[model samples]
Target: MSRRPYKPVMSKTWYLKQPSYRNYMIREMSSVFIGLWTLNLLIGLGKLIQGPATWSQWLALQAHPLMILFSAVTLALALYHSLTWFRAVPQVMRIQIGTSFVPAKLITNAHIGAMVGFSAIVLLATLWGV
Candidate 1:
């Protein structure tokens, strides 16, 4: 007699069952938006390379209400992805000094601080047309 191996079934939304699992799923999903945003940027670059008319059209397309909304959503997801990534850094990276390891909060806070500082610099430069 041949016996079939039993396979356990799980819910499609099993990730929603636990807070950690849900967060993990959300973080993973955010990558899709980030990737799409990056793809949009690449397309814009290609349009720019195609010359002034194409570039202007691409810029106009970005100015549309739907594109504006999409940018806002993408920005939010990117921020969430960055924060979660910073939080995970300390867990994955063990930075040791003598007999002690760096605190997770310190590592995460440093990353956040650097991000803010760089963002401010970029904003200033953009505003100043640098």
Candidate 2:
């Protein structure tokens, strides 16, 4: 019996062929931005603890053009990640009530609504603080 040769044939761009795969990759990439933003926040918090001058410096850095661009990108990525997660809920979580199945759209809408409500509260608190 002859041994067959193993084929090395995995394509790096396979995800580009399908829209869903592309969306998944984009959503996954959002985590990197999220991590960067979280680190930025932690550093800001540390600065705040140090003194008002240090905190002001941190805030000044955020006003830089590059920082602004980074913040915009991160915000976009965060929104995409959130929306993708909401879209995925129906597939991962199933709701049932005594032999009746809940609608997927309803679950997704509820998640989005809650997010908006929480965000509104945060915005209001921030305005109140200012």
* Residue-level lDDT tens digits of model 1 in 31-77: 99989989999999999999999999999999999999999999998
* Top of the candidates by TM-score: 1
Off by over 4 Å in 2: 1-8
Question: Model 1, residue 80: what's the lDDT?
Answer: 91
Candidate 2 lDDT score at position 18 = 96
Global CA lDDT of candidate 2, please?
A: 0.95
TM-score of each: 0.92, 0.89
Number of residue pairs clashing in candidate 1, backbone atoms closer than 3 angstroms, sequence gap of 3 or more or interchain: 0
**Candidate 1: which stretches are off by over 4 Å?**
1-3
TM-score of 1: 0.92
